[model samples]
Target chain A: GEEVAQTPKHLVRGEGQKAKLYCAPIKGHSYVFWYQQVLKNEFKFLISFQNENVFDETGMPKERFSAKCLPNSPCSLEIQATKLEDSAVYFCASSQSTSGGHNEQFFGPGTRLTVL
Target chain B: AQSVSQHNHHVILSEAASLELGCNYSYGGTVNLFWYVQYPGQHLQLLLKYFSGDPLVKGIKGFEAEFIKSKFSFNLRKPSVQWSDTAEYFCAVRAISSGSARQLTFGSGTQLTVLP
Candidate 1:
């Protein structure tokens, strides 16, 4: 089975509207990660969490993007105000390493968001 | 900063031809490496991974890669290519023992277009 899962395979919103995406990490996995792929570029890291505690958010673009990992529910990434530049595919990944060891990260189907 | 690099940005080849995608990383210490493929309209899937043991690792769909510690490289390869093999290939890495080592450092990704 796929290790990570994401919801809302596709989404479209106005420039000023809000958009939210979800991710469910693999069972028993303690680390979750989010990435964004814009247009024809690479997948850029957004944030990462280790057991509900943020481990690193250095790649995250502040000012409108935020994410959270809660117990029993899928982690989420919310954008307050959509921008045309935000139209891209968002990928979520998970790993089982709590100590940041050599665990392989598993990726999800990803959600393609189109901001109009 | 730790990073992954893919030499070939776009590769086009005919069916039955040999395939090789170069990937390199810049990080000191033990690490886990992986090659992922994202087919058109499909999610990213792990093709193969290398942790320890032999440097040459094989992946699904007839893909394989070699881990060169000295050069910090993990390149994907295939003996005979197929049109179905056309997709985006990504190289990712994470240190085996380090803070946030579970987080992946991905490359810009290479677009492989196998012609039939």
Candidate 2:
């Protein structure tokens, strides 16, 4: 695929319920990133991966938020015990290796999550 | 830590009017700057990026941005805007140092409404 792909255009979850989102990076991309877009369109980085390996997790909430990128599978982001603040649009992006300073990320259609 | 600021929350312009969106970041180190646009009901698309070299970078749809290292700003501009250009614009930055996550830090988006 030429573009990053995301599943579940919209997801509704009750408070304290679990929510999961999936993203498939571009065919040749090696870096995948997740971001949360909250009200007022503020984007917050959640996590990033490099070829199925966790490249950075500093932005992820350790308590309830977890993510994984396994070979031959789409990456997943799961949130346990969802709260009102968790309602947001989750965007996934992929980019080629950033070894020599090229870091252009291609984004996917985000999944809008609503926590009731 | 790096943070981006987009001062204009909303901008309204008539067709054929000039456009400019201000973006600033707070980071002392070298950085990569990018501008992304999201039309209604669509995913984000990269408008332009500045990794190194030229301070002024041009993007698709007649969009251009200037990166001012001294001011830590990357302002997007267009000589004229059309109604089809109505969309949300976001400015992002990534630190270019070792041990950095290389994840983008985005600004609160600016909504552009072009009236015909």
The residue-by-residue lDDT of candidate 1 on A22-68, one tens digit each, is 99999988889999998756788899998789888988878999999
In candidate 1, stretches whose alpha carbon ends up further than 4 angstroms from where it belongs are: A1-3, A98-100, B97-101
Question: Clashing pairs in model 2?
Answer: none
Please write out the lDDT profile of model 2 over residues B45-76, one tens digit for every residue.
Answer: 99999988989999999999999999999999
Model 2, span A27-49: residue lDDT tens: 98888999999974878999999
TM-score (C-alpha) between model 1 and the true structure: 0.93
- Roughly what TM-score does model 2 have, to 2 decimal places? 0.97
Q: Write the per-residue lDDT of candidate 1 for residues B1-116, one digit (tens) a residue.
A: 68898989999999999988999998888788999898999888899999889999988878899998999999899999999998999998877565544567789999999888
- TM-score of every candidate: 0.93, 0.97
Question: Every model's Cα RMSD, please?
Answer: 1.8, 1.2
Enumerate the chain B TM-scores of all models: 0.95, 0.96
